[model samples]
Target chain A: MKLRRIQAIAVKEALQIVRDPRSLMIALLVPLMQMVIFGYGVNLDIRHIPLCVLDHENGQQSRNLVARFAASNYFSLRRAAGSDREVAQALDEGDCGIALVIPADFSQRLNDGGRATVQALLDGTDSNTANIAAGYAKSVVAAFSAAAQLDAVQRRGGTLQTQTPVGVEARVWFNEALESRNFIVPGIVALVMAIVGAQLTSLTIAREWERGTMELLVSTPVQPMELMIGKLLPYFAVGLADAAICLGLAVFWFEVPFHGTVATLLFTSSLFLTVVLCIGYLVSVSIRSQVGASQVALLATMLPTTLLSGFSFPIEQMPAAVQAATFLVSARYYVEILKAVFLKGAGVVELAVPILCLALYAAVVVVLAARAFRKTLD
Target chain B: MTPSAPIVEAREVSKRFGALVAVDRLSFAVPPGEIFGLVGPDGAGKTTTMRMLAGVMRPDGGQIVADGVDVLAHPEQAKRHISYMPQRFGLYEDLTVDENIRFYADLFDVPRDVRETRAAAMLAASDMLPFRKRLAGQLSGGMKQKLGLTCALVHTPKVVLLDEPTTGVDPLSRREFWQILYGLRAEGVALVISTAYLDEAERCDRLALLHGGRMVHCDTPAGLKARMPGAMLEVVSPEPRRARDALAGQPGVRGVLLIGIGLHVHVDAAGRSAGIAAALAAAGVPVSEIAEVAPSIEDLFVALLDNAETPA
Candidate 1:
């Protein structure tokens, strides 16, 4: 209950963080680097699609098709070859994103007023990019059909008419621009909290146990609950500080919108951090050695946060069993909470489920940590 | 010397960690302002007993009372009367010396003015004044141990438990550390210290010899020495290794330990030194000189362990 005691402990802990540059790098520098990499590395909207053209027929129709592909910004003509094998090799080597082949019978079919199908091959290594490439290729073919019809109408001089087609409208919610930064920065904030908060608490408590300092503290008039709360406070501050920096960068630097209240964002992130720190303390108290504590802490935080947390993958899209397992990942709900607050500007009523889940996680972890800590020094 | 009542007492206390019974039915009491020594080697449960008495751990069986307060029942209340410095006495290596002391003082809720002056006096007594501004981690091993002791006693507890505070310290630092403990004893503080060095145990007002989770003996150093059935003999010879081999398990010879080139043999104090000389001479081992010596704590410990056939 004494502020001075907590302050003393917090000051010591913060000094340790300042003294160790490697921890600072992991806590601060890495978040920024991740912000930039995840911003660009994880894009769903593919641009400057590469396509190899194989035109076996030296006719006007084939030339015109190649021109259409080159004229559009979506497809960049990488290489023009006479053999299908060459274009396939380009796709195999990842030199081109897609390949277009116009056969030798393309001019004969066009002259005979018959439909000639041109082959398009796309690489599906990156499913997102491959999907975008497929859509763009279809649109290019549609545009080519409309241009050919219009040219036919001009040649026939009002006898033939090119008629209308269907139109579609698109609207995006949450992130209208769908900038990957908006999606990734929030997740990076959660990840940073997990890594930094877990490591700080693990080292602080485990080192005390190893060095025999906890015995002194236990022998004092300090209550176990007081000690646990005091230790958890400083690390909670560190996690909150890192989250603030991440949020600031996401908003000002990356231009990601923060539609929700800052207090709500801070409070939700603090709950996630509390859960992480409690897990770290539990690991520290259970294991006597710092190395052992660190290994357990890293595995405990990283596995759940990365795989089951729905950070990179959507839980809804996963298997039913995986979706069921996501409930066990404390950070999964927190990541959702972060996105909702930062991107969607969700209010407390709208995010009640995730908030409640986080509160439950925090309570369970804190109780377990206190119990483990009570028996550690002995 | 009105025989002050026992300030700390443990009756039939026992603790077992899985298959290992670390403290077995150990009972000891430390009167006020006395230095009680718990002497044992590694894994001998010295730390376990200290932890129990310090109220950091509850004994699996039996009761521990510090100043009439049940250690297990009201541990936090009992802890207010004691300070415990474990084997690797914890120090905040990153913080300045002043900060480490202040942190402990704050934990114990020491008032501002009293804590400030007490900390200053403690640092001065331990000869750590000039180093108050230095980082604890950067201090030498001995200095760090002293700093740990200072921090432990900053709140002026009635009893202090030190778990081998000088195990790895040099002989000079060990002497200085004992001097500090003696000073604290003079201030009416009950001091319970655990150590592996039998020689250090000689300085205690009373010693508790522990071996294999059991107390072998508890008495004053001289009293334990008086219990030894034989007198320790220092035997000098040109061939000590050969002398030890020849004297091994010989009649009337209880123990033979190598001290440099000479072998210290324990024998009957009533007998003449000539008997051992003659015994070694008849066994074809050369003996230069033999003299009867007083039994040290080490000698008493060796004799007791040998008599009990327990692994020392």
Candidate 2:
């Protein structure tokens, strides 16, 4: 409760972090590394899918159809198969993700004004990539058919043409390009903050216990709450600094947009940092060992923050049990706030729920950590 | 020195760990300017008792009044009047010597002027002024203990509790550490230090011998030795073990203890030494010297344990 006492502890803890190179590396370098690696390494946008063609007819129409698939950036033509067996072999060997099989009677049927059919086969091992590739193929074939009908109409000298009754023009808001990095980089701020704030503090009190400094502190006039606050203040600053670094990298380095003001970001980040640091302090108080505290902090903060915060995966698609468990993770609410402010340009009004949740989590965790920290060795 | 009111008192304090009793109805008082030693072997509840007095642990039964404040009820207030140094000095290995001392100064909210003066004085007294900028981890074992003492004495509390402060320290450092403690006592500070060394126990103004969570004896060094039940005869023989075996459990002999190249036989009276010498000679253990001598603290401790076990 005393300011001088708290300041003393904070200064000592900061000195320790500065003196220990390993802790300094964890606080500063680890976040930067995580951002760079996760930003570029994990890509959800699929491109340059290899495609194989079986042109049995070897006609102008078949070659034109194959050129359309090649012209699109989504697909790259690997080879032209002479038979169905060869196409199958290429698909089975994983040489191509998609195959276009043009029948021999395709050009003859079209010249006779009869409909011709083509077969498109896909490798379903990686289902997400397979589905997206199939959709692109379907769109390409539809465009070709429409253009062919228009040519036929002009040749017959038709004055008018029928039009589809309905049109669906889908627009993706927030992220116009639908780039996954925009969403992921913002969420990385929360994850990095959790690691620097919680994991670093998780070792502070435990280190004191191991080194026998807690006994001296407890024997003095310092209060438990004072010790807890002092221990957390330095790491809280480190966590905020880490958050700022991540924000800069996301906006300038990774090219993710930043729609919110620095004030809002700092406000939300402070609340989230408080919650995580309290969790770390509580773990240290309970375990009271350096190695044990580090392992528990990783499991309690980093794992849950990355997995349950909807940072890397969608929480809506998670099983009901895990969905319920996400409520206990403070990172879930922080991620929501970051994504909203960064992508949606949402203000306090738009992010009332998540902001309130973060404040509540901070309050509850601070109380619990203070309560768990007793002045006695017992 | 004239007797005065106690600066620290424990009234029948007891501590239990599950079903095991670590401290049983312990009672003691430390007055101003007196060095009280809690002398015991390992697991004698010396550390536990020191922890309770320091207000870092609560005794399940009875009361601990430090500086007239009930430690269990107002631990924070009680802590302001006492400084505790644990078995390990607890110096932050990463912090510089000056930083560690300043940390304790700030925690105790010592006035800036007082802190500067006291810190310089302590450093000079402990001969640690030259290593103020050095990291604590790099300091020698002796220097570390001195630094721990300097930090603890920063606030100049009324009572100081030290738990086995010299257990790992070298003999020269142990002597220096005792010199600093003597200076503190001269300043009218009450000190309660625990140690496993019997020689160190002799340095205390008074000491309590603890065994199995109970205080077997509590008196000054000379007083405890004076309580030795009967005459102690030093027997010098070529065969010490055989001499001990021959003399032990003989007529009028209380106990026989081996004390480095000689046998100390406790007897009901000084007159019994002649009978013991005859018994040793009959058992073919030749004795060259036999004479009555004053018992040391070790002899008293062993005799106390023997008496406790036999209950005579």
Candidate 3:
């Protein structure tokens, strides 16, 4: 491959990206837009669910129970119902996501040191939200039960130790608060790089075919290897720039933590960028029309990055077949590395498996992309 | 004359697409400082032939040598001396004219010092020097074809294969394009151009008449026209359509075409021309002039192909 030919191709591609409004928009603006959308908009964590309460007894115990639900950050008091019908109304009208119903004999039963059940009615239409809300409500009621048991023992003058006999203390790591933003922001970085990188490079070769420039271009002294290298050099730089933009926004704009070294982050990012660029180049080589190539590139890169890479959904949640397929999706490895580096403060040594996977993926695709191009039309 | 050797030679080159034979045993050679025309209408394997010579395609069953390099064996090496333009003017509409030329110059490894002067001269010759800064997309169809030519010639290739460069271009641009081609010939560049336009065929140093992927005749324009099977007589009458009708089924009258200013009548031989005139006069058509005329390239192609198709 001649370096001069490579430089020439790269320069011409750079001019085209600048001249085409569509390509320019994709390269320069898509990354930032995707980052903002995924970072600030998509949140997996369910919080601040509207809750309505039904009190059958006017006892202090029931009132105190309602107060506990209101004080917790997980639930906010939207309405206080005097009757069961009111609670049913609030749940049916979608005024509340969940309803807390207390029994009339609740205070008497709890005073007797017996089990008292408080029913939680949830909106099951949004099953994911409903399930998480149920879990939160269980924890809140559990905490409230523990405290009420202590109060009953002291009021009865029994000789009970103030300290609990057994307790489970949960200490969260990596993300101590379990903030979904910290988790989602890093994944968004990988996703944006995959989309913008693949999209921009997807049009590179296909545009030539559509515009009839491929005929003259293939007739030149440029080798297939030289043409592939020349075509990818400009896009490689653009991919890296997109990486910098998305990663910078993740750390500074969204306040996602950066626990890893800059060298490792940049190195791993470049590796992933190489893989995605090759994927786009391969799509361009296979499909001659620009629209067809762009769509196929999206299918090859964006779908895998967003769905199977554990970006929006967890890879482990997929079926066995699809989970195994995620290994072929290069974005899975990059997403793993980004999340580790951002939240866990993991370095290269700690994340060697994913980095190696990404590097191997990049090597294979580079070879494929280089072999895919020929200086012949047929 | 090419004193040393030809810059391009295609020998028994054949290509097939699935079950369709696009080109069969198509053999032609282009010497230096000569313009060789592959003359045929659409689907006569003109583009395929041009492609094989340009090293942009693989000829299924033959040998192609360009500048002494085996095109099929080492296409990339052969490409250094060849410039191929497709039927469509392959200019990047988004890029400026100067940028497009520079791109090709770079790809062909045109030296930094020589590239400037070469590009400038070609642009000036094509009268595109002033529009160098304009985007190629904004140029007229004729100008786009000229830009395609300029880019193709930027590398000073030994053999240039142009595939219908003026197919859709305006008449004015077509004339201007020929001027640039003659200049290339003056510079001793071997040019092989494919065109369906027979008028363009007469200007070439030699011509290949192709029909259905086969070269039926390969000769100079004068030579091909001389092979016309029968005499073509021009009848100048006020009512030419009626004159054509009157001579339709007359003895020895093969075909009659209503052309501008007259009717072109084909007969079995030159001896039948006088009989056709008499037939037209006897039919009471006012015949102003009835005389023999040489066949144009189109008429010759039709008659020659007809002659080859019929059983001798």
Cα-based lDDT at residue A139, candidate 2: 86
Output the better candidate (1/3) by TM-score.
3
Residues A1-378, candidate 3: write the lDDT tens digits: 779989988898888877777766667788898889878788988888999988888689989998999998989999989888998899899999999999999999998878888989999989999999999999999889979878887888965676778887999999888889998888889888888888878988898998888988888888777888888887888788888889999989998878888998999998998888888999999999999999999888777778899988988889999999999988899989999998888999999999999999999999999898877878
Q: Candidate 1 lDDT, tens digit per residue, B56-98?
A: 7888999998877998898878887788898875777878899
For candidate 1, what is the lDDT? 0.82
TM-scores, in order shown? 0.88, 0.94, 0.93
Q: Sorted by lDDT, highest first, which candidate order results?
A: 2, 3, 1
- Per-prediction tally of clashes: 0, 0, 0
- What are the lDDT scores of the predictions, listed in order? 0.82, 0.88, 0.87
Candidate 2 per-residue lDDT over residues A223-298, each given as its tens digit: 8888899988888888878888888898899988888888888888889889988998999999988999989988
What tier of docking accuracy does candidate 1 attain?
Answer: medium
For all the predictions, what are the DockQ values?
Answer: 0.59, 0.83, 0.78
Give lDDT: candidate 1, residue B308.
Answer: 61
- Could you give the DockQ of candidate 1? 0.59
RMSD of every candidate to native, in Å, equals 3.6, 2.4, 2.6
Return the candidate ranking by TM-score, descending: 2, 3, 1
